[model samples]
Target: MPKLPAELRGRGGPDALMAAVGRFSDLMTPLLGLTARGRRPAGPVDRSLQVVVTSVRAEADGVVSVRLADLAGRPLPGWQPGCHLDVHLPSGRVRQYSLCGDPRDRTAYRIAVRLIEDGGGGSREVHALAEGRRLTVSPPRNAFPLAVTARHVFVAGGIGITPILPMVQAAARRGADWHLLYLGRTAAALPFLDELAPHGDRVTVRTDDLGGPPSAALLPDVTGATVHACGPAPLIGLVRDAVRGRALSFHSERFTPAPVVGGRPFEVRLARQNVTVHVPAGRTALDAIRDAVPDVAYSCRQGFCGTCRVRVLGGEPDHRDNALTDDERRSEMMICVSRATGLDLTLDL
Candidate 1:
């Protein structure tokens, strides 16, 4: 029999150790062909739901909205405005897309994707998908939830409008005082304009071509409103700067990973592999660990997916992700965006 990692020998209590053992068994089943007594060897169980592409509509220059429905015409799982789904592509790539359609509609779920020519290939695959194509997707998860406020200020940039659109609709239905400032490079590149038409003057459209690049001064007065912004890092930074020392609450969601504000070089010890890797001050631990363990799972490198999570055997982690709860942080870390506080840290691997 093969030896187990030192941390899994007797530590982590019975439930934790058993969970780790089960994960190990799942990992090893493909390589070892192990099975339960008197049962045939089986592949990993896929708990994701099966959905078929119902429609594909071009919303803008480089953006397209894809509608997904259950295979048997049954109602899909309910979701909120800021929720997103983890879509598994045919090329084995997983990407998270915000739920953009009306939450009251249970017949199907809608997501929009923007083509990135130089990106990691997920968007291109989504664009290539045809109607009737089957897909496996995880249930909707919300890392960004709408706050219950009497007044709201929404700022959306380009494709970032996907999640905010539903929020705007919900706010209007509830008769809340809300406004949206939509920004993009060109009017032709902006999406879902017809949907926002009913709101009239409450929605303001700004294009770089018409009025130069955006600045913090263009934002409306967020005096007593809850401000929600989503966009590129620069736009989010502007929102943060505008809300600093203000009386209102500010929340933001980003398409890119948060930059390492105060990072330092550290050493990571992978106990199972008995290897040590150096993490540079400018690089993430995920990039370094992937050099040794190429099969490490990761998606949405933005630190919101929790797919790159690993068990921490030792050392204190400076958690930077928005996915994990306070309790989960005690024994787990998302290596994609998190780092160690001290000189060295250890992982179960």
Candidate 2:
């Protein structure tokens, strides 16, 4: 038997390696079969890559930036300004972090995490990572893509600046008219201020400690510029309200899952566990299921990462996630952001 690399050994030893190989074989079965021709399969497939953390540095109060590179020193995949990586932690917890480093630098990818002491343990796990720590991450996925417009207005709040930083850099390189409104609860909590120094006056720094709180008046004139905002829901809402009835285009991404809009109460039956979970209006099925199944996996509850996808054995699904394709929607649904259209749904669990 050939020796497997350390990165491929995984925590489950040989058994895990064989299981992974089996999954890969299954994924390729259709492609190699004569009836399939050369067409690829529908829906997403796991193409996670192993990387070693080369550097970790504190970017601000309770925030740190980590740099990861391929274990074999090979160039990683190229990503756009708004792209993010689904990082799998050693504890089997998955989390999404925006790719903040320069796209031209393919040797390594940078991601920042802010400590959320009271929230899930993902950020805490990331903060504990040290140099040379190994991690598996999904290929870069972009939910918020920057448009190729002449003028751009960016609004960033706290850690939300991670994705906006790369967009601002891209806009400057293109010689497009751009300005950034970087807001934080306090100046000390903001990360990557040094990186934005080159942009000079084009960047606006406003902290709640210094200036009460951000309002529509603080927003720059977005008349002809495309507005890109990412931050707390309130900040994004302010920008959305400001841009309403205007001639400009608006895009925004949230750090948290969007509030359930027009949601109706529904019940989800876990077939394997023989249990049923009730999802109330304004609450996600993921949350309700976790009450019965504590170890359910999920990341980026915003519905773009596809980590919480479950097989729909019966009932109609009100698919609201962006990760799944039409083919996937037929049999599977993302339980994090998507819900049932009817009163009940049966899940594979």
Candidate 3:
């Protein structure tokens, strides 16, 4: 419940906070280091802390945002726009959510969860939590980060807007040129329309019930601009194809697993465990590895989280994960999605 050092709160500017956090990163991880693609390795050190749920309220249809605070009225660790927290649910299901509240407000952290009826039960458990509930959570870890640019363009689909909201506000606070193209199934399904309305023409809301779907028209000329998008896989795919030949740089985050097209059943040879696990063609390598090991660490099995990363002593990996860098992929592989290009893969375990 103790407050982070005054230097961490930026009362003395960011340098002090960065240095302090970096020095104590093992206790509470630092948030600055990111790949060129705005990604961080998944297995951040064990730094979970306890916090109380101060409030819980509905944001939109099937979406609820919760506010968390330290029990002793102290400032929490500083986090930027695209960072997410690992929420350890009472049922022992760990889920990740983006921080949507003001980055300047270190006193409390806010995040929104969209209930997925068919999900792995994480959202359902979060929705059922009451006020004053205590929860274990990791310090903020950012896989998607906003680039410092003169002009920024944001595109968010459905519940994916949770991370982009803070980025928009950060841009506005810094007087950077920014615009948004927010899409949803219906107006009622959008969470922050009322808040975004005040931004005027800077924000555009498109719903399937009214405007059909967002087209290239909603996107401005991305020439020399940095684009940030988060949403369903299909929307991100469309954006990728639409901007294929443009000079713009695009960054995106998706909650869904990457399509493992044409992946064949492969064998994972656990060198340390001395066992051979067959990863079925349709199933993920993580599933097969977990079946054999039963205790391997993994989170966000969608390939974004690097928790399942292991050294590939042999075999050519298909490498479907979005988290690893080209250099990192040479030696390590995220077992959650990446599969063997050849018949068998030998893992260091």
Best candidate (score: TM-score): 2
* lDDT (Cα, 0-100) at 66 in candidate 2: 98
Best by lDDT: 2
Instruction: Report the CA-based lDDT of candidate 3 relative to the real structure.
Output: 0.85
Query: Which residue pairs in model 2 clash with each other?
Result: none
TM-score of every candidate: 0.78, 0.86, 0.75
Clashes per candidate (backbone, < 3 Å): 0, 0, 0
**Candidate 1 all-Cα RMSD:** 12.0
Give the per-residue lDDT digits (tens) of candidate 2, residues 1-349. 2343454545544566666776776687766652234555566555789999999999999999999999999999999999999999999999999999999999999999999998778999999999999999988989999988999999999999999999999999999999999999998899999999989999999999999899889888888899999998989998899889773799999998889999999999999999999999989999999889988999999887889999999999999998899999999999999999999999999
Better of 1 and 3 by lDDT: 1
The alpha-carbon RMSD values of the candidates against the true structure, listed in the order shown, are: 12.0, 10.6, 9.9
Model 1 per-residue lDDT at 70: 97
User: Can you tell me which runs of candidate 2 are displaced by over 4 Å?
Assistant: 1-46
Name the TM-score of candidate 1: 0.78
**Runs of candidate 1 exceeding 4 Å displacement:** 1-47, 245-247, 268-277, 288-295, 311-317, 322-332, 344-349
User: lDDT tens string, model 3, 1-349?
Assistant: 2244455444653456556665665444335554434467567556677899999999899999899998777789999999999888887767788999998998899999889897667899889989999998889999999997998889999888999999998888899988888999998888977778878999988899998887877677777778898998889988777766673688999877766677799899999999999998888998888778876767688877677889999999999888999999999999988898889999998
